[model samples]
Target: MRKYIIILISVIIIAFGGFYMKHQYDKKEAELQYFNQAKEKMENYLHENYKNIKEINFSDSYSINPMGGISVEGYLNGNKAKEFYGIYDKSNDEIGVSSVDAEEKSE
Candidate 1:
């Protein structure tokens, strides 16, 4: 009876280990696909703005998990978009011309 219990326990552990490894494999595959997609998107954006963009990044070391940092999206916090700081300066004045010219006057 003792030997049977030990065998059953070992079998359960092996089963759990296999399941855990499979889960990790699936997670890695998902991460790779996500990064590939993000890379394609970044390339598309850069190509669209090739004339305007100076530099660009496709991905970072941030994890795709919900309990992690920013990657494609900013954050999952239930906060609405808020303006950090903004100040506008506008100048309006009458147009003026310089008092100097290349044309010569008969003195």
Candidate 2:
């Protein structure tokens, strides 16, 4: 019957919509986890290596790089004008500081 067909189509639509929303939610949660991990690694590195760092601040935006690491940017000691960059490698559970010049901010 026509009514049965209409109901079937509506159910299909609802199922697809629910799946799409769930996918988006999962993606956002993964990104947030990565961001948090990166931030924590950077914080620990700074604390262990530096003495004058009182506070750490990170930008709201982060990206997963092609090299399978997360790149983060932030500033230290509430100095938002200066930039602090860090790369966190998930595989080794380490922060990559070789490319980052934490002592000097680029103009």
Most accurate candidate by lDDT: 2
Off by over 4 Å in 2: 97-107
Q: Local error of candidate 1 at 51, Å?
A: 1.9
lDDT of 1 by residue, 1-107 (tens): 99999999999999999999999999888777655554444444333433433333332443443432123321112222310111111121111111111122333
Every candidate's lDDT = 0.41, 0.81
Residue 91, candidate 2: how far off, in angstroms? 0.4
Worst 10 residues of 1 by lDDT: 82-91
RMSD of model 2 against the true structure: 4.2
Deviation from native of the Cα of residue 74 in model 2, angstroms: 0.7
**Could you tell me the lDDT of residue 85 within candidate 1?**
14
Q: Candidate 1: which stretches are off by over 4 Å? A: 52-60, 65-107
- TM per prediction: 0.52, 0.84
Output the lDDT of residue 20, model 1. 100
lDDT per residue for candidate 2 within 1-107, as digits (tens), equals 99999999999999999999999999999989988998899888777765577788888898898988998888878777656787899999998853333453223
